[model samples]
Target: MVAVRIAKETGLAIDRVTFKSSLTLDKATLKAVPAGQCVTRVTLEATVYGDVTEEQVTELGEKVHVCCPVAAIFRHLPGCEFEPVWTLAKAE
Candidate 1:
């Protein structure tokens, strides 16, 4: 939904959007409160189709991070990185 909103904001028509998520937690650090989950990162690879420009894709990338609530929540945590990658479909 976050991606859809940003894509709409950027006016980039999109096809299926898929993502993979991996979360890391440290048991010792959970007790110690060390650097937010003992260091964590969420990398989102967005595969898109349709007649979207690179500039639009870039805008979508920027907007999603800035507007995403989940991202906003994690923005303040230490060692938390949100890596977003946008991939345009290949011409066939």
Candidate 2:
């Protein structure tokens, strides 16, 4: 949502945005030990489709990170790591 809004605001010609998520949790937590943060790491791959350049995608990704509230929450949590990967694709 944030990406689309930014694209519209900036006139980036973005047609759509898609993402995939992968998460890792502490082994102890998985074992039901309850001794550490449940989520240890998060990886999000965001693909923006439309007429865009690598620099544009990179800039968009940075802006999204700064604007995304959910990402902010994960960033503030202790022992939790968040990684966001942004890329561009030709609009079909």
Tens digit per residue, CA lDDT, model 1, 12-62: 788656665565665567778755667576666776676887777777767
Candidate 2 error regions (>4 Å): 30-36, 90-92
Best by TM-score: 2
Predictions in order: lDDT: 0.70, 0.87
The number of clashing residue pairs in each candidate reads: 0, 0
Please provide TM-scores, in order, for all candidate models, with all chains considered together. 0.69, 0.87
In candidate 1, which residue ranges exceed 4 Å CA deviation? 24-31, 34-36
In the range 12-89, model 2's lDDT, one tens digit per residue, is 988899999888888766777543467889899999998889899999999999989978877876788999999998
Note the residue pairs that clash in candidate 2. none
Q: In model 1, how large is the Cα lDDT of residue 6? A: 68
Best by lDDT: 2
- Itemize residue pairs with steric clashes in candidate 1: none
For model 1 the TM-score comes to 0.69
RMSD of each: 2.9, 2.3
